[model samples]
Structures are given as C-alpha cells and as structure tokens.
Target chain A: MTATNSFFHPAFFYIALAMVLPFIRGRFYYWRWLLLVPSVVAIISVISMDHGTYMVIPWLGHDLILGRVDRLSIVFAHVFAIMSLIGFIYGFHLKEKAHHIAATLYVGGSFGCVFAGDYLTLFVFWELMSMASVFLVWLRRNPVSTRAGFRYFFFHAVGGLLLLAGLLYRYYAVGTFAFTAVDPSNAQFYDYLIMAGFCVNTATIPLHAWLSDAYPEATVAGAVFMCAFTTKTAVYVLARGFSGFYILAVMGTLTAIYGVLYASIENNARRILSYHIISQVGYMVAGIGIGTLMTVNGAVAHAYAHILYKGLLFMGAGCLLYAAGTANLDKLGGLVGRIPLVMIGYMVGAVSISGMPFFNGFISKTMTIAGAAHAHYTWLAIGLEVAAVGTFLSVGIKLPYFAFWSKPIYKGELRPIPINMYIAMGIASGLCILQGVYPNVLYNLLPYPAEAMKYHPYTAWHLVQSFMLLSFTGLGFYFMRTVIAPHPGRNLDFDVLYRLIVNTFAFIICKPLAWMDNIWTNVYRIFGMRGLLGLGTGTKWFDLKGIDLVVDGTAYTVGDIGGVSAKAQTGRLQDYLAWTVIVALCVFAIVWWL
Target chain B: MRNWLGDWLEKTRIKHAKIWMGVFITIMAALVIFNLFIRPHHVEFGYDAYCGFWAVFGLGVCLLMVFVMKKIVQPFLAGPEDSYDSNE
Candidate 1:
C-alpha cells in the first residue's frame, strides 16, 4: 500500500504545516485554536488506525508520508503530541512569533521522526529537528545562550550527519532504506554506527555535554519542551534496534554515575535537571541493554514515566526562572510563600523523579533494578540503589529546598503564575500521581508485554528500604549542609574542557595571528623583504642612495676581493680574464689530462 | 563574633514552614493513596525481598522526618519576604 493519503494522515501534515502557521497567522488567540488541530489529530490517530505506511499528497511533489502508526511509534507520537499541547498552554503568554514557529516546528519535527518508517524519511525529519530546536536556545539571544545554541547545533548537526551516513550504509548493506528489524545475529558496523548516531542525541556519555550546556541557556518554556523529547526518543530507538548489546549496560551505568556527580555539585536549576535527565535515561538505557523480556518492558515503562516526571521538573524550574528571573540556588529562596502552586508542582516532580515509593518513577525504576538482579547483575543493582539515593538527595530535597524553602537571597514578589501555567502543571502533577498509583495505564502502552516483566516497587520491604536509603541521604544533606554549599552560580560541566582550554587556546592563537598578520602587512609596506619586493623592479639599485653606495662600490669591491681571495666561484670570468685565462687554461688542461 | 554571625547569615539556608508541610502532606497522600488504591499483583517471585526493601525504607523515612522537621523546617519559616535573605 502506498503511504500517501493527505486526508487520512491529517495529523502529521497539519502539524507540519502548523509550524509555519504562527508566522503567517499573526494573532495570539488564533494560534491557540490552531494548536487544537494537532491534539485532535493525535487522539484520532491513536484511536482509529491501520498499520501500513500512511502517505499524504495534498500538494504535488511533496511526497509526504506519515508512516507506521503502530503501537511502538504511536506511544512516542502520542506523548510528543500531548507535550506540545501542554507546552502551548504553558507558554500561552509568549509574544514572539518567531519562537512560536520554532517551537511548533521543533515539536512537529519530532512527531515526524516518530511516524517515519524509513531511514530517508527519518533523516529529513531529524535534520529539520536539528535546525528547528536551535531557535529555542537562540531565543534568549544572550552571549552565553548564543554560544550555547551554536554548540548545540554543532552536536546535533554532527548527529544528523552520522545518521545520514549510517542510513546510507544500512541501505547499501541491506539494499533497502525501509525500517525493518535488525537481527542481533547480523549486527554489523552499520548497526553499531546507527546506534552511535542515536547515542549522540541520547546524551550518551562523552556526547552528554550538550544537554547541560544548552538546556540552561534556553528560555524557560523552551527548556520545558526540550526536557520531553530528544533523549527519550534515543531511548525509544535503542529499545527498537540494539536491545541485546551488553556494552550498553556499562554505558548506561556510567551515564547514571556521571550525571549524579555533576548534578550533586551543580547550582543552575535547569542544568541540574538536565544532568538528571541523563541520569534517568541511563536507567532506561541500561534496561534496554539488559535485553530480557522483562528488561525491555522496563525500558519502555521508564521512558513513559521519565517523560512525565522530567517534564514536570523542567516546568517547575521554568516557573522559578519565569518569575524570579534566575534559577541559581543561592539567588532564590522563600519563593514558596509567594507562589505556593509552583512549589507544590516542583515537589511533586521532585518526588516522582526521585523514585520514592508510590511516585511514577518508583514504579518504572524498580523494574530495571529487579531485571538487573534477576539477570545476576548484583553489583549493577546495588549501583542503581545507590544512584537512587543520590537522585533523592539532588532533586527530591535540593530543588524544592533551595528554590522554595531556602532563605530569600533577593526580595521580590511575583505576580501569580498565569492560569494556563497552573493548568499545565496541574495536568503533569495529576499524571505523576495517577501513573504511580496505577502502573497499568503506562504499562499497557509498553511495546513489550508487561506481564512477562516481573518486578515490584511497592511491597512493604521495598518501601522500607527506599525510605531508609533516602532517610540516610536526607540526614547526610542536613548535617552536611554547611559543607555542601550551593553558591549562587553555574558550575561548568563537560563542555568546560572545550570552553575554557581549547577555545581559549584558539582565541590566544587566532587573536595574535591576525594581529601579527595585520601589523606585518603595515610594516612590510615600509621596509623588509616585502617592501623591497614591492619597490618596482624598474628602480635601479643605484637610484637608492643606501643601495648605490652600499652595494656597488666599497661594499662590493671588498666583498668581491674577499670572495676571490677565498677562491669563491673561481673568480673566473676566465679567471679575471687572464687568471681567468689561466683558470680556463687549467680547465682545458684538466680536460686534456682527463 | 559579629563577623562569624555575618558569615553564617550569608550562607544559602532554606526557609518556609508551609511549603515543606505541604510537601510532607503531598508525599503522605501519595503513599496512602497508592497503597490503598493500587492493589499489588503477586508474581512468582514472592514479595519477600520487596517487603524488606520498603520496610527498611519506611523506618528510615520516619526517623529522618524528625530530623528534617527539627533542623531544617522549624528554623526556616516564611515570614516577611526578607526573612531568609539578609542583603547588604
């Protein structure tokens, strides 16, 4: 079946077009109504769909295909669609049309990637996503943000290029660009390369630097949008393609540990959350790497839970950034008194991400721990438990405490957060609670069978242990509060190596090189070889007094005499004509002798 | 003494009674609601290990709640806007 039917696949096409609608439509109220089109389509797409590729060709030459609305793609697409609606509501008061378009295109592009069944289609959507999301970071227009956006785009562009290469190679190797199953038995260089492509965006280890660098630079709403999609999609890809790769277990564990360490020391609120994103996704990735039926199920479940809790945390941080104009730990305090709703929102998110018993994260994270233990990865299980404690320390206690409970470092009264922000946050908070209470709702969305996965986060003992671990950590936080100081500033992360040393070196080199080049050109015009060369060849050496006296007379005479005495060049114009004659005679004699 | 006092006040200390109280209530509400509403389904692996994990966790949480209430919460109340922050 050809995948093109414009009328049927209205969701993908309309959302794609809706990206540009903001620029043309102009009115603020109109865009809200326009946002409804995709939300409706998302619901429609989920409820009533047939499996083969769906293509739309309303406009000729635009071979648009909204392919594969299967359960796997549907889960990602549905969350992305819902996220866009929530983001729209949260950012309803934004005035910039450019940002609105950028945001819409970014979300729409992610959805497009979700529905793409072929590598060609995925590549197109991937590059568009790379281009579109940069605007979210660039919207701030501060020097810090501008630099961050450039770095973000640089990494994304590199990822997209790698994806293109992998896709082309896969197509060459298998003779098709279609999204078919990759057999673990036939895992080749292309498969590994494709997985690497996914890892770059997954914020996988060395590639993980961009998340902390760019996220804090984005506008609050932009950061909220960012928290939902990119890395989660990478997890989705891993769950699909490289499920049995054992190295991923190591990769995921490192990512988790690396994230916790950075987050522990970081002060910028959004950056802290960004590092936590890596940490949490590490759990998901490790689950995928473990690759048992239960573990894969856990990976999908974690993705679903992560989207909600992480988005909630970002939104809370967004709220703080929105009202107080800063998200530094030291700069903010006592905000809970003023904006009680925001604090409630933040704490809900914190608990959910911390995997405390009865929170959404607890439900998902437990599966990975059990899966790891069941697989006899006892050390890994213990590591995850320790990481869980760190999670609560950093987010559960630290975020709300500093932003809401900490002493007010600055005096300010914020106007009540807009009603729409409340509505968005409320929905997130409700989902966090609901999903925690009823895991079956999210479990049902898993591509793998939930029953096949055996794990429990909430038996009496599991509750006691998690509580105990968190308790000890809490004691550590309180007793060590004086030593664990949170300075009111951003701590540099992975990119600092590049930003400080490498970039400074480039600056140190390039600045002087350019200056030297500039000053030398000026100096060259006055004297030196360049100045000499620039003096027209027609100018005789005698015409210049210094050259004439210095070169032609006493200087040349003495130099020539010295040269002849040294038998330099034989001094023979036939050996000074006669000695030249004698030398020529000697040359002839030598020739005769020979 | 005065210098030490100034330094102490300058640190990033947490404040707010109502907020942490709300946090405590929310957490309890979540625990109770999930415990009651979501019935735990039994799998082949018994809840023995699971029970142990939660039991220990609960005891620790109870104990820590006391310390948090005393050390962190009692001292940091939301009074006037500047209660927690002393700006020079």
Candidate 2:
C-alpha cells in the first residue's frame, strides 16, 4: 500500500522522466531501452492491488496523485504503457532526441492526467500532454506538418481554456477541485463548460475535424504517438466526469458514420486509419453516453483495445512510409510481395480494426453493440453495426486491397523495410492476435469491478453469419474488380472547405476592405481634405489657426524666462547665493500670484 | 473436400457478388426494423434472436459496401496515382 513498496505506483514518474532523459542529453541508448520503463511499470501497476488515490508528492506544486487504480484507469493506463513501448520499439532506430522526448513527455503527461485525483492536477498534466505532443507533429519538418501542428494546438488550446474556465467556476462554487460526479441534468454552469473542454479532445462531432486533418500530417512516428493518447484520455475524462451524457451517444454515432464516409474516399493509407480513429472513438463515446455500467465499461474496453490496434495500424503505415517513401494507396501496390512482414502486420491491424473474429476490435466492439442492444437503443446499435461494416470496408478491405494487392503503380521500385520496423510491427501484431484470441487479458483491466463480458467467437450461427458476410463481399470484389480501377486521388471533404473555401472567403473579404481603404484615401486626396494632419501641421486647424495660438500666448512670455536664466548663470559663490535668494523670492511671489 | 468447398465458395461468391450491396441494404433495413419494433416491445423475436443478428447483417453490408466502393464507386472517384497533379 505504501508508494515505496508498490512497484506499480506512479513510479512511472521516474520512468517517464527517464523517457525524456534520452532527449534531454542526447546519447545513443536514450532511444533504445528507455521506452520500455513506462510499459514495465504500467504492467506491474495493472496487476497490483493498489486502490484509492495517492499523490506522488503532497507538498510540491506538481502533485500527481496516483489515485484509484481501479478497473477503468488500469485498462487505459495499461494500454497506454504498452503503446508507448510499441511506439518506442517501432521508432527504435529513430535518432532524433526530439522524437523520443515528445513521445515520452506525451505518454508521461497522459499517465499523470489519467491518475490525478483532482481536476487542477489533471489540467496541468493535460496541457503538458498537448504541448509535448505538438513537437511530434512538427518533427516532420514540412510546411504541411507545421500548419497541421498549429491547427492541432489551436483546437487543444481552446479546449484547455474552456476546461480552465469550467474548473475556475467549479472551484469557486464547490470550493473543491477534486474530480467528482456532477449531474448534467442539473449541472452547475462549470460542469457544462468542463464537458465542452473534454469534448474537444474527445473529437466530438463538429470539433473532430482537427483530428483527421492534423494526424496524417505528422511524421510517420509522430502519427503513432498522436494515435495513442489525446482522445482516449478524453474518453477517460468522459468516463470520470460526464458518464451518462445522452447527447454523446448521438455525437458518437454521427462521428462513427462520418468517419467511415470520409475514410471511404480517402487515398492515403494513414489518412484512412486516422479517419477510423474518430469512428472507433465514436463507439466509445456512444457507449459512455449510454450510462449503464456495462456500456461505460464497454467504452473503457474499446478505448483500451483501440489504442493497441490503431497504434499497430499507424506503425504499419509508418513502416510502409519508411520503406517505399509513400503511403498513398494508389502508388503502393503489391507491397505484400516486397515487405511481406509489414503486409502481415498491416493485415492483423486491419483485421483488428475491422472487428474480424479472434481480433481485439471484435471483442471490444461487440461489447458496445451488446450494451446498446441491452439498453434497447436498437437504432443506435444498428448504426454502430452499420458503422462497423463501414469500418471493415474502409480499412480492412480497402487498405489491404490497395496497399498489397492492387496493381503496382510502384511496380519495380519496391524496397525492403528496416529490421527494427518489422520487429516492432511483429510485436504489435502478436499482441493484437493474443488480445483477440483471449480478450480476458484486456477484459480484466476494465473499470468495472469484475469481468462480465463473455465473448463467444464461435457459435454455429456466428460462423455462418461471418462467413456469409465475408464470402459475399469477396464475391462482390472479384465481380466488380474489372470495374474498380484502383488509383489514388484526393477526395475533398469538410477540412477542404475550411482550408480552401473559407480561406478564400477571408482573402476575398480582406481584398475588398483593402480596396475600400484605398478608395477612401483617394477621396481624401480628391477633396484636399487631410483634417487631422492639417490641424497638427499648421495647415488650417486648431493648432495653427484656432485655440493653440491663444493658449500659447496666455501661457508664457520669453522675457520672463530670460530673467530667471540670467540669475542662474552667476558662478561666484556669493553671486550664486544672491541668485538663489532672488529665485526663492520669485517662487514666493508666484505662490502669492496663484 | 477442400477443393469441393473451395469450388462451392467460388461459385457462390461470384453469383452473389454483383448484388451484394442490394442484399446487404435489405438485411440492414430489416434488422433496423426488427430492433426498433419487435425487440423494443419485448416481442419474442426469438431468444436474443437479434442479439448477434446485426453482426451477420453487418458482415453482408460491409462486404457489399467494399465491393460497391472498389468496383463501382472507386472507378469514378479514383484517378491515376498522380493524375490530378499535372506537374508531377
């Protein structure tokens, strides 16, 4: 129970701090084994019997309470730790200290945020997480990345401001900053404000546009880090703060549907995966929105499962980017033959995201669907199911088809991927399979007190349904294969409207304003009317022709000033005394005049 | 047996391939109605009959969607790898 005896405690502080050690003082080993420390501690913590929140240090301004290591936080923390390790391994050969530092800080910040018992402590670390992660996106060293990182920061900054405002209001009202339940139905204004802050990071609907736009632009490794934290932490916040906010269900369902549609049209392999991040989070948000213990548990479970597979998928795409110099699906055909390992890794990740049987996504997604069905929100469940199908279509079928099987646009130029990259992906692929096959590994960590989800991967009906669906889809693909010419091109969506149309509108408005100013200046010149300038410069205004002449005449006379100057110029000590006496007499005389 | 099963699968796959979207849409619509009307009222739609029904229906819908996308939709939407980028 003591922090010293418990290895699973925020012992992550040293480990996370150590993750930054490599980047702080650039040495070779910083990037290698330092990544594993957080993961090791996270695993130990998950298995440990620590309950109730405990601060890392009670006295410091930075009080990180490793409070309440229950089922939910454990699940999230566990996955985050594993993801940090996998991501580190994936970028093992990356020599940049910035990349390592950003990853460590980002993951470490998330860890601190999740374990904090108080909202004040969480906000401090939450902003840290945002500040730390932006460097990852900027590491791409491209204009696109620079712009994307700014947009990413802009949204998060707004979210942080909203959260702080809410916290301030709550602190004023309740006189306590500890994380506690607040009912949305009769919520203090602060609660709604805080929830809005949480939603920005959660990528809830209208606010979600930044995630898809920004994530794909990060450096290959950067995207992996982006995929791992942020939104999932918001899901954590949702679980903790606004557990049963019903509107979240609507938001989640719409996000799921929207993600799939946009993903369907996307050409970049990484972009497709990024879209699915929103889609999967939608399921989690919806589950949390349902408010049932089982459903909220499902959201927690899904967030845990999603981090792993989504990270894996991003890693696979990164591997493709590393080897072939492109992740554009059109240009990346028959890569399966070249980088079979990466292809396999991508397939595992794709299957997992697709909710294929014996995959991590299947176990997690079914729980959400079941929770909805249990709640008798059949329509929401149906939307989830439809979105699930869309998920498979956009990622499972489309990614593999274009990347591995489609006719090679890069037919002769394929290259082998790096060994470290393959090994990293291999580890992730194994974990995905293992978690899918035996989901109890993941299920045990849910915030719920005990394990309740029983996944039946094989029933007669289940197999039949799965087979019928897969086989028919396969049939459809082959029949229409001739018609579907696989090629890569940009398909504009909501982000494009902002980037192109809205920007153009700003330009147009500014141009007219500029022209109007020009016209106004011309009119002034035409009339010879420079009123302000004329007044100041003695053209024909108050300074030269009006009140200034009278005011100056009344204020002073040159003769009065000359008399004082002559007295001050006498240098002899006696003369100086006499001059001083005269000045003193003048001072008394002026006082009498006043 | 493997060959026979494979042959049957190929035959079935090809025959059902073109209309998979239509079939999927129909099943999804039916499931929606089932969940909305029959299940909500606690009508005996069978023992948790629709419980995993969506999964089955989803599989069909998913496969058909990919098919329609890859075959019909993609051709119009997808262009040459760098077709739009004239300079490239």
Model 1: residues with Cα > 4 Å off, grouped in runs: A1-16, A19-28, A56-66, A450-456, A497-594, B1-88
Candidate 1 local lDDT, A1-594, one digit each (tens): 533442244335445655556456554456655655665676566556555667633322234454666677767766676777778778877767677777777777777777776666666677667777888998987756765676686567657657766766775577666665567677888878788888888887877888887888898888888888788777877776788788787788778867776676667788889999988888888888878777777777888788888888898998888888888887887665467777778888899888877778888888887888788777676667656766887788777777776665458756456778888889888988998988777777777655633455667746744555565566557655654446544444455443444445545655655565456556555565645874533343323443344333433333332222223322321233244225433543443354
lDDT of all the models against the reference? 0.67, 0.69
Worst 10 residues of 2 chain A by lDDT: A555-564
Predicted candidate 2 versus true structure: per-residue lDDT over A1-594, tens digit per residue: 555454355435534565556445444655466566666666666567466556555532334455656556667777887777777777777777677778777887888877777886788778878878888887988655665666576568668878877876786687666787678688878998998899889887777877876788788888888898999999998888888888888889888887886687677888888889988999999998888877887888789888888988998888878778788876777555456667668889888887777888877887787778778877787788778777777677777777775664356554555677777788888888898888787777777736345544445444344444444444444454544333557554454333454345545655555565556455545666555555334433432444444433222222111122222222322243345446534643453354
Residue A161 C-alpha lDDT in model 2: 74
Measure candidate 2: CA RMSD: 15.6
Query: What's the i-RMS for candidate 1 in angstroms?
Result: 18.0
**Clash pairs, model 2 backbone:** A53-A67, A53-A68, A71-A446, A71-A447, A72-A447
Best by TM-score: 2
- Residue A341's lDDT within candidate 1 is 73
Off by over 4 Å in 2: A1-31, A56-68, A449-458, A479-487, A496-594, B1-88
